[model samples]
Target: MPSRAPDDIERAHLRDPNDRRFTIARRLPPEPLRAWLRRFWIPVWDVPDGESAAQRVLQYPVCLSITTPGYSRFVGPNPGLSTTVLEGRSWGFGTMFAPAAGAVLSPGTLRDLAGTHCDLEQIPALAGLTEPVRVLMAEDPSAEETHAACCALVEERLERLGVPGEEDLLINAIVEEVEGDSSLLTVGQLGERFGLGERSLQRLVSRRLGLTPAWLIRRRRLHEAAGALRGTEELAELAARLGYADQSHFTHDFRTSTGSTPGEFARRWRDES
Candidate 1:
């Protein structure tokens, strides 16, 4: 396997150039499935004996379905950073699902499973896929055909769900709006833009996404902030662009979530880059 750049660098994750024990490949889903699934990522790792490496992700505000040699799970939207450790020579096949698709695939409401995961075998639609996906990944974790076969299995399962319902489409659109528009900084603004009342919007988001509308805005800003910090933009200007009242407020929020001040994070990013 060869080292490839991340599919979306703005999305936060921890990586070390010195540790070249892993290679990841990400491919977009088929066009018809794009509305429900974001992409498929396959990561193959070969850590040396007696050593371990950690992979951290500031996950997007959506759900994930990940299959590894040991386990297969349906992971809910994580409200904060997530970390996974890797050891030995192994691989993982994971999919980032759209906001609307979580409820459809999860055994219970999204609200019940936030920040946690359940066995994939529990989900009727996804049960049969675990073993086959695992076998294909094990055979050739770095092969293009392996990736396509995994995707094909998922696509076949999802096609049985038929067209997404009206609410599913609405939530997908709502997430798209929140992610694309930097000007939407508050729940009120999001409600107005979507013609939904605060409580109604809150209910919809919490039920389908297991998160508050406010979290959606903050996550988007932080993701953009992390990406922007890699550049040379002034802190004050960056804060203003992301709808923060001031740089201090922005720094406070970033520090609270990431345990490091924006300046410190930026410096580390620069040093690492």
Candidate 2:
């Protein structure tokens, strides 16, 4: 995959400026794990007592997160933006799984988890790994140590479950194609390009990802739009570029997903900086 250039407006998608109470760091897993793992992300936050900050995200297609003082859980894809409020001092380490990789650790289809979370220990494949991880996390390990521990745990689980199957690879490819290509404007376009009928495409995504193809496409487009809003582009042009019919349509969708209009979002980033 081509790396994003420094000036690429899409880089803003990786972060949010509305909340400055935390720092996030990411590390790639070992090469052998790249097919099923995207990266391990650690977020460390320190806030004054009685105050809180809201962290919002245009989350990826799927994730399996482990948090300190919280249960390890598998989070499926959500159709809209997700937000969490942070208070006091806190930290969390999470693995952003490839679209189909979650299925390997899940007891049922990914659709069952869509827009929801389940305790990771409930999954037979992940049952025994959480306790050791909890012990390691309690000691406040360094980033490198945490990454190594997570990699090792995942490796052990993969050994027992076997490598992700062909279906996983197929789902990963479809997600990558849509995410990497901005020209893919609609689910129908994706269906045609992937050579699957619209209904079949929806079924495949629902079964493996627990999300509708339309939701996936809309989420990707909204992510791009949110990123571009942090830059200087005109709303109409950005909306058209993202395949919206007009500026009004884009504004409505953007506000609905992010709770702020494009202009207000950009201005907040500008004023914050």
Candidate 3:
């Protein structure tokens, strides 16, 4: 029998019966794009249809993804922050004051982003930050966890630098709200809580987060809803707790974002715990 090649949109690899860590074969050409940013991107990996040996990795960097359902490219950046896009079933988001130019970045765009080993490992007096210099940055398993941890660490670093506490406070606030309950966090609320005008906070957060406050709210709530459905609650209650008006709303949003319903997701596989 002739062996079939991998299809576009599916990354395939030879799988070992035992030892399931991660396996990536290859991917197809990304679908062409109309616009760069301003929406979520759907990159069908140009790999084969094979079991993802990787235990659905939950960790990666934390950079707000801004692309459309159409493509994974980006336009000009939100000021004061940068992102290092990576490849995986998941993505990342975080906030960092854009470092000065001439600094190294992760392997996102390297015509080349990394110059030398010194730049790669320097850690820039900002300790928690992983320089965008890793050849295998995207492949790291604990990527998101590490990035979120870095954000927390950078909070302390900025404090030591005598940066005004508000910006860092605001970052922590958004992170907490996103990590917890985004249903209640609003841009207007952030402005009122921090005494900044709405526009000002919007600009600040957009610059730092690379996303609007509403995006953060939606991302966090959706994330929580997914967690609740898989780990904690039934679909009906999960939808309500995550602030969806009802289960149908939850199903719609979930299918739109993840291409699956709560019941489908829950029943598709056994709990890994």
Candidate 4:
């Protein structure tokens, strides 16, 4: 019989990351993040509740996103990094797509990319996805190498769409915002800073980044709150800093977006910590 697959590796659309929730001690190393998934998409089963699934994908600065077959044939705003779990039945391999400059739009009112398995040239309205894309994914080359290559090719195409001479600035600004306050900064605020009107900024952000500025900021804040939950920061205090008017409000939003309340998240995190 073929040697048992390594524990670190698993077959497609099978394994679940939901049974157990895990927290990274630090930022997930980019090397590993960029490397192929040794197993199927791990679900973040503990986001807003008892368990969500080990699968979580997000786009940060310019709407960095992680996708699976689950997002296929779907549209509409995803809440909380838009945490979505996808199975190989629709798509395979957990892939991460980062925006280098512009925005990425979900194929709203369009068919899922998995349906056609189309090559780059055949992909419809891809220009509407985003600009300056950097996609990374790994799969058994012998079995699904073609899809893997397709992802890479798509990344190259998107990368070419980065905003002219503004990729670096946009990335830095978003990162800074995420790293800074958790205040209730509105879309208009984000747009004004970019020297664009609210609607214009929204269009730019949606077109190039694939998400609204609000989603990006909210997700980052939630991630930070999750990180801070186990630290010295007071629970009530942290929630406020993240722009939650009160603990209940923060708890509700966190659970809605992440699938777990702040107290529960911290408790689980403490167990893990």
Candidate 5:
């Protein structure tokens, strides 16, 4: 298990500092696979006999490959928040694919799979990964050797997909730029920076990530808010900094996506911590 303080973790995850039901660890893909693979994640969990814990994520706009004891599948971009309930003792081995990998992995257009997932066995090219990863995670869910073996298996499979092309790399750049820079507030600003017109940028993101540029921006803002609210920052000041028109608009956006007001969320996080 990786020993990371809750406050130091990635903002995309909505983690409770007091929750001890699960542990997560991350490993980077080797250099050659970086163009297609982001990183590998292994999460092992144990809950009391009759209770359950819910894990939430503000997912990135990319595809995912996950294998657990009972299932193996490819997950498309999630349009909003993602939640999974956990019980008993178990583990999951997952690959967070880069933006460029969606086109190569999807049997049809990536757009068709948004907000959904497909079984790995349903896709012939990736079917080889299903059984091997399942067996490894089931046999030794917590060993470093087991995790390394899983990554080696995936590396072999993804290497056959070949190198990402120029357009594929461009899409990667576009997505990274949006997530990395907070000052990029509008789609027009994004397009101007990339030398792409509005329509062209829209079509490109739709084709590769199965998401609109506008939605991506909104999601980033919410993720930032989720992290910031853990502190003592004033709501109005936080809203202004994140480019929201007003605090009312900020509260509405946060509640719409998270089912909790910004103030409510901040209080809950503080109470737990």
Candidate 6:
């Protein structure tokens, strides 16, 4: 089984650490499903009347989530930060999908869903599981029970669809390699390492993930940089570690993706903390 520790780089993206409005728990699924499922997450929140807390996250590659008294949806890769306001009392359970798992879960190509959220009922393969999922989550079961129920639902879906193909595994492997190595700064470099021609690599990723190899590499660097901003003031060193040419280049990309300079973001987080 994969390690259960949360991605430390992702944890740094939280909008507020001082706000005591909610709690989140994450667990690994059973061994059979790990190839397709990243982790199961449950977030429970209660806000005082007339007061609301906003939770912000730099979403993982992809996700399928069900909110209580709410809706069930599959969210594609979001290029920017995603934020939701919490009011009253509410909870949600979500399945974080592996990068290429969408190929098996969606009837259409993943490109169609990029930067968008689709209702689970709209997808043929996942539609049947929607209502049963709602009933199981509505009962407010314990974490262990919730994990078991979700695992069963996913297992059934995989069984019906059959196992993922080699193309799916190839796409996933590419994503894993980029995420694991910061030195891979460009799609050309990534292709060389994987022994694929640049255009072939691009075509493969675009077909399966609806995203380019460059986008995946840049997003991973930005996510790690966002996490480091809170702890380090040496922007140049941070940029070097993230494989950027220099601080200026890193600043440009960070502002483009996050809408704020690293220094400004760090200052705001510090003030709030």
Please name the candidate that would achieve the greatest lDDT relative to the true structure. Answer: 5
Clashing pairs in 5: none
Best-matching candidate per TM-score: 5
**lDDT per prediction?**
0.85, 0.73, 0.39, 0.43, 0.86, 0.74
Point out where model 4 deviates above 4 Å: 1-77, 80-95, 100-184
Model 6 pairs whose backbones collide: none
Worst 10 residues of 3 by lDDT: 30-39
**Model 2 RMSD vs true structure:** 3.4
* C-alpha lDDT of residue 77 in model 3: 26
Q: How close is candidate 5 to the true structure, as a TM-score?
A: 0.94
What are the runs in model 1 whose C-alpha is more than 4 Å off? 1-6, 17-19
In order of appearance, the predictions have TM-scores of 0.93, 0.89, 0.46, 0.51, 0.94, 0.87
Candidates 4 and 6: which is better by TM-score? Answer: 6
Q: Return the number of clashes found in candidate 5.
A: 0
How well is each residue in 1-273 modelled by candidate 1, as lDDT tens digits? 212324693356655535689988887776677668887788899999999999877787788889999989999999987889999999999888888889888889888888999998888888888999988888888999888888889888877878888998999999999988988889999999889999999999999999999999999999899888877899999999998989999999999887778898788767876
Question: Which scores higher on TM-score, 5 or 6?
Answer: 5
lDDT of 3 at 51: 32
**Worst lDDT 10-window in candidate 2:** 1-10
Q: Please list the residue runs of candidate 2 whose C-alpha ends up more than 4 Å from where it truly belongs after superposition.
A: 1-18
- Candidate numbers sorted by TM-score from highest down: 5, 1, 2, 6, 4, 3
Off by over 4 Å in 5: 1-9
Estimate, for each residue in 123-168, the C-alpha lDDT of model 3 and write its tens digit: 3443324433122235442343433333344344434443334454
> Cα lDDT of model 2 overall?
0.73
After the best TM-score superposition of candidate 2, give how far the Cα of residue 245 lies from its true spot, in angstroms. 0.8
* Candidate 6 TM-score over all chains jointly: 0.87
Candidate 5 structure quality by residue, lDDT tens digits, 63-101: 998888878889999997889898999889988889999
Q: Predict model 6's lDDT versus the native.
A: 0.74
In candidate 1, where is summed lDDT lowest over 10 consecutive residues? 1-10
